[model samples]
Target: MAAAPRWRERLFALYFLSHIPITLLIDLQPLLPAGLQPPALTELLQWYAASFRDPLMLQPPEWFKTFVYCEAFLQLPFFPVAFYAFLKGGCKWIRTPAIIYSTHVATTLLPILAHILCHDFSKAELGGPRTQRERLLLLSVYLPYLLIPLLLLFTMLCNPHYSHTEKRKRK
Candidate 1:
């Protein structure tokens, strides 16, 4: 017999599904002709752009305001699903509050960075022209945020090093 999705699982599924609208909006942004792809590898080529004019203090294009709102709306219901999933799924080892908090932090911060880096494509104006210093800052932060989750996820799945101890009681 197939197992039905638990309430928490159902909620997470919904949260993941809801990302479609945001994806649609993001994908719908104006794009460059095929020839421009190589030079405008970043998000700046579009009518809307994301740039890193400020390092310590980052800003994004106007469309980002709507994007961020959609992101938060997506996340609001997701945290608990992750929490409950951790407890219930036998992956409790990876469910530390710190890890959970980091997940939240990562999700929240990446967009700001992504927006800054891709500002050229952003439809709205954020700030002045990009500088090397701002570029360096964006470059450094980029890969770590992108990589860590994959590392954590891979560890959770492949190696059992991060496993939690949950003993089932005997009848």
Candidate 2:
């Protein structure tokens, strides 16, 4: 058996650990701010509830058109392409992606965190409970945001050029 890279082990551990509170955050979505009700969070939980492996964006509210537009126009497809180049690309590009994604997460979660920290329930509650259909809808919408960085982090740890078995043999 090949030995694992320290970075890959670390990154995978971090990602796996993060899944817990993220799911909790979903369970507690009713407690988030109106302006940001966990962003793409609802979708994942809904998918789980419905026994779907992959969340699909169902019917979204007309008001959410802006989020769809912005996500499509601004963040999706680009961050990873850029991040992959940096992580797998060579040189020191990790800093850029790290900064950008950290900023993105902060901006994305700020509303809810602020409300919870600020103790403003009225401000935090986005609307109401998550209906089955609504949960499915939210999961689809938020999937890219949740799933993409995961890939970046995973890729950063794994170096295909160095097979795990080879690394072990060398050791």
Candidate 3:
């Protein structure tokens, strides 16, 4: 039962601290109507969409909107759980929230990535950027959605208590 390494705690702190602004910028802002949304927020959203060479921000499907809403609301509860688990280096009661959050990130990211990678250009609702620079920018924005949760999940799995739990199940 040695103390967690300094680097691990620091990494967790970075992850936890980032979620606050991201929750507001990415998760919460789009939930607002055009009238209520801040002009800066609107411009930021437009820039992101445009980076993909997408000229229009067409309405997402109702089911997709519901899914986004669920993702947005879930961030509220998860923020505290993630902060305590990672920043405090505590494993107790963390596995469930970590699993749920990781699962949500995985499930949501997969379809979008698939559509971006696999869909026919003629038929798709979203299209890839026309220029290499925009494509790179798009990847820069999206790569985090793929990497961070996965890295966090890997960090959670690295806990000795989690390893012990697995070991105990084998006995």
- Evaluated with TM-score, which candidate comes out highest? 3
Cα deviation at 67, candidate 3, in Å, is 3.4
lDDT of 2 by residue, 80-153 (tens): 44435443434234535544654564455443223223332232223322355544453454454445455544
- Each model's lDDT comes to 0.45, 0.43, 0.64
Better of 1 and 2 by lDDT: 1
TM-score, one value per model: 0.35, 0.33, 0.74
Q: Model 1 over residues 1-171: C-alpha lDDT tens digits?
A: 222225433443343354354334442232223454444433442333334344222243455455445445554455455545543544443345425534654665577566556655224345533655766655664455445444444444344434444679999
Q: Candidate 3, which ten residues in sequence have the lowest lDDT sum? A: 54-63
Error of 3 at 7 (Å): 2.8
lDDT of 3 by residue, 12-103 (tens): 66776787776677556556786687778778877767566542233454655665677677766677667777777756577667767876
Where is model 3 more than 4 Å wrong at Cα?
A: 1-6, 52-58, 120-128, 131-136, 166-171
State in Å the error of residue 103, model 3: 1.8
Clashes of each: 16, 5, 0
